[model samples]
Target: MRYDGSNELHARQARAKLEKLIKDKKIFDLTEKKPQRSIQANKYLHVCLSYFGCQIGETMEYVKRNYYKILCNPDTFIREREDKYLGRVKYLRSSSELDSSEFSLTVDRFRNWCSSNAGVYIPSPDEERLIQLMELEIERNKEFI
Candidate 1:
């Protein structure tokens, strides 16, 4: 879920809750470190996603192109939240003030980039819906710009 909240307190509360979930290993399992055996990894790959530097499709491309690399060190494939918003948008403390009006445009651009240069056209049809999700995120952060 997006971490946008009404204020610092809300944000902190949300962060705490999310972090707690992480700490409790409810959101993601630590033992599932091996990408192949991990249901989360496969589910993550099977779904569309957008985070930081890599788009869902691009990530899939990276995995396709460098499966061995990812299998060798899964950390190399991990995407951080901060990397996604660094220069692209301003930091808004609350979700209410955010605007992602241009999210679709951004997604279109990223998709074009992915299709033309990233690799073979997203190999999996099941992934297109996941890529479309970038629109929501774009809308979520529209005001940040």
Candidate 2:
């Protein structure tokens, strides 16, 4: 159940319900559910990564892991796991977890970093040139899709 936290009456009603549940020994969990990243933004990210990969002579996965995530957006994707044989394992948080704005920020940081660090001039997602490039790539590489 959801109620507007800002509205006093709604908040009181939700609090009373939660209190009743607690008194009755009911178990529940709560979390905020934000909208996931946009499909268009995801497509732009892949296009940017693919172009950067071509420029740097590496695959998109390599570029995304080494350059984009590590260099541009450091310390944003840390995760941990426990294994029976290997003990504790630390890994990256998946990019899919980021909401639309966070993902866009990461992409922008990657482009800016590429320009300054690697001398690769990646266009911003909204640029007309980038759109053209995306369309051109899709038309040429139909098999990859």
Candidate 3:
């Protein structure tokens, strides 16, 4: 989906510019005394890799192992992932005061709703409980998965 303030063309343009800078060594220049930039470089690479369909952890590992410029900035990788998923959806603005209670209730209702909607009542109570446990696990790990 497109973000409200950006389009594919703009993104492509930005990427192209970054590619040009990297190719020209402008981004890696360190002739004079310079502040450390390995972390920033790596984080930005992770963001780019993610947009190109790499998983966050995999992209992070690849950049860390291969890139001399980004070996230091671990926080950048995490923040990039956070920025991608949480884009434009700030928690302060999106969350309600009742969010904690509402979220738990929603999960419970969803579990019951799924069970009831199954074609037929499952014969074994243990089987039903297993299903509920699996569902809970799935719900809890949804974001990472």
Candidate 4:
């Protein structure tokens, strides 16, 4: 269920569809009034990353460290550096991009990554539900696109 990023149109369509699902789920209203970098925001990001296999094993501590850095100045450290620091191979999008898009792409990328890497790890039932929702949305809307 990995999104075909090579197909730009399909990728954009998938992203738009996921964005709508996220808003409908009220996953973290990034409305103008909301503080973009609050504790709540970090918690939301943390949960999302955790669900996407970013916090496996000892990666939680690394995620937390970079998460704080992202909270402070997302534009400074690029995604490449973040991946290196996390000891992962490009598992995350740039903090600047996430900040600029209000984390819309972050959600899409995480979903895409998880879908392609399924069976690598087993998520909890609760996490599975969230992933399924996203996957269902993608599958249902992708046809319409």
- The most accurate candidate by lDDT is 2
Cα lDDT of candidate 4 equals 0.47
Pairs of residues at least 3 apart in sequence or in different chains that clash in candidate 3: 38-69, 38-70, 39-73
Which scores higher on lDDT, 2 or 3? 2
Model 3, 33-64: lDDT tens per residue? 22333543333333332321222233423433
Clashes of 2: 1
Model 1 spans > 4 angstroms off: 1-46, 50-100, 122-145
Worst 10-residue lDDT window, candidate 2: 136-145
Candidate 3 Cα outliers beyond 4 Å, as residue runs: 1-98, 119-145
Q: For residues 1-145, could you state the per-residue lDDT of candidate 4 as single tens digits?
A: 3456679987898778779878788554322233245554455555544433332432433543454334333444435533536664433444433453555444444444444554333233257576565445434444332
TM match of model 4 to true structure: 0.31
* Cα lDDT for residue 133, candidate 2: 75
Residue 3 displacement (Å), model 1: 24
RMSD of each: 17.3, 3.1, 21.3, 18.4
lDDT of 2 at 75: 64
Clashes of each: 7, 1, 3, 0
**Candidate 1: tens digits of C-alpha lDDT, residues 1-145:** 4444557876898778768998887854322111123443334333323332243324533433343123322333233345554744322232112133232232334344456765523323246574456445534544431
**Model 1 RMSD to the real structure?**
17.3
Q: Compared to the true structure, candidate 1 yields what TM-score?
A: 0.22
Q: What is the TM-score of each predicted model, taking all chains together? A: 0.22, 0.72, 0.19, 0.31
